[model samples]
Target: MENRIHLGDCIDVLHEIQENSVDLVYLDPPFFTGKRQASSNKDGSKKYTYEDRWHSNSDYYDFIEKRLTLCRKVMKDTASIFFHCDRNAVHIARYALDKVFGPEAFQSEIIWSYKRWSNAKKGLLQQHQNILFYSKTNSFKWNKTFVDYSATTNIDQILQRRKRDDRGKSAYLRDKEGNVVLEATKEGVPLGDVWDIPYLNPKAKERTGYPTQKPILLLERIIALTTDEGDIVLDPFCGSGTTPVAANMLNRKYIGIDKSIDAVHLTNDRLLSPIKSESNLLKKGVESFLKKDQWIEMHLTGLECNPVHRNSGADALLKEKVNGNGVFIKVQKQEEKLNDALNKLVKLINSREGFKGILIQTSNTDEFINNESKSIKIIKSISMQIREF
Candidate 1:
């Protein structure tokens, strides 16, 4: 089927689609944020917006339920639906979703976390949205994906074999002589429920001057996780056609429905030449912060290690490990003392991130303290050693 966007009330459009033909449905409807959601082009030459305000909470819930019910009608038995919403009416959305898809089919409540700069407000700054994942049935299609290991993962121990003892405790499998058994090679960790995707910035090349437009990367992940190539993905509330763009990029057929004439035109315009903003965060994974940190690069000279930037206490993640935990490295600053540097490193490792690190001795000191956890390995700098001699 050709990828296209339909214009009309989503509930009305969904009724026209062939039943049991859609493989996946992703929707990002109005969040009931009690205001008119609006955005404009980078130069402020164009603007787009939509109303999310309602007469009452009952009105909002009823509107959500009506569309959700129709969405379920067109989906195949093995299809899955991802409903995206904000905290304002997430409970209403979730309740309606459970009623339509059944609580037994609930797969996950995925949190889409992103960083944004907001002006000072009386309340806490909102940073996350909810995406309820539910399959039409238990036998839904799912494409398993793996993400890179965390900064403090026990890289070595991940490949080791383990067995349960008589007491039902998990321990490493050992031979008669007590040698640990090794398992076959494995991929990285499985994708988690929480996703850290960036919001569409005004400067982003993919931004289409559309209100509440989500990053294509976010839709790409949802499309990749549930549908394979050539699968039919449906989006009843496709704003600016993000779902269709993502589906088409992945070689999947898509049907997008929107009530606004402008939305349909923009979707068609984008599909003709689907431009995606490449995310450094996704390309480099979580480790991208490490590679981008100039401070870590300057300090970790001559050492082949991955610089970890997410963890504030740790500096460089050495390409090695001990006792199954990753090895990390921290260099003392010019104004910082040896103990202060070591304390920061120790605290990070003890946080159960499963990491070990070392304090690079860069100054003269009479203090010699031992890390009780044995996670920090100190390496004296050549300048300090020469001064001592």
Candidate 2:
């Protein structure tokens, strides 16, 4: 599974995959969006769009029921699936999923709220989409994502006004020995089901021309928080191949499928040109150009959190020799400031006997030395973004 796109119907393609192979599944299947045949080509050439149609509720259930059964077969015991849909077919889809994957496997229904351009007088604006998450087994991976609290929420103001304890931290009352014990606030609050992440607007850097294409950030968050690196991700209804693109960027192996030949070609073209910045949605497409080995190297240093070392030897080496994705130098106790740490790390990397490169995670701008500093090159981590020379 070294970055290849499959062209065919999802059910047929999924049947070819081995059982219990995929780690995660994120699908945004065609909603019964009645109009299937639209002018697809840029020059107004005639093109047929694959439309999902159902005459009755049972027909829709039958359609989803068979596909979900196949999806379950391909998923590992610990694998999870996210089905994105709207109100039109969500209930039937849920019923089919429950029958196929079991009710116990039902997870959260993520509400993706966004703005729509419609008159308010006629009816309430439909501004949210639904995503149903399901796991194959009880023992599954779930890394909770910490979304930043909205600025408009009153909770922020309430939190700010709370009194502080002697340690200068926000106070929370505790009941102990019939006395109130004030403690500091926890790191952050749990994210709720009603996510306020806006839909991909026209000006958004990640916007691809695909009408139903989702933001890469949403997929990235799901993939990162749900599974470990090197896990296999599958997207059967891979419209424009966003799931595979996100999986590759996050160092996950992936399988993507689509019935539309135009979509397949569009996805292929999108993956081929890695340097062109079309939009924020397309930035994740850059991962398509990276080889598995290159992805490994980038994953080692580029990820926000500490990279999950594959081997115990690598873990030991990292723990003993590296600090924050870089080989650390024992700077003087007083010289541990940002600038000094950068200089010491750079000097150590340059002085090393046989290392090819060094990645320094620091806030200082002086992390990089001249390129001519022997065979070693510098990589600096400013916040979560990494830059290499």
TM-score winner: 1
Q: Estimate each model's TM-score.
A: 0.75, 0.61
Model 1: how far is 295 from its true place, Å? 1.7
Off by over 4 Å in 1: 294-389
Give one digit per residue, the lDDT tens place, for model 2 in 311-379: 211111244333334432221122235444435444655565553334343434444434554433344
* Lowest-sum lDDT 10-residue window in model 2: 308-317
lDDT score, candidate 1, position 104? 95
Candidate 1 per-residue lDDT over residues 82-182, each given as its tens digit = 99998988898889999888899899999999986674877888889999999999999988999878889898898789999999999999989999988
Per-prediction CA RMSD (Å): 13.0, 17.6
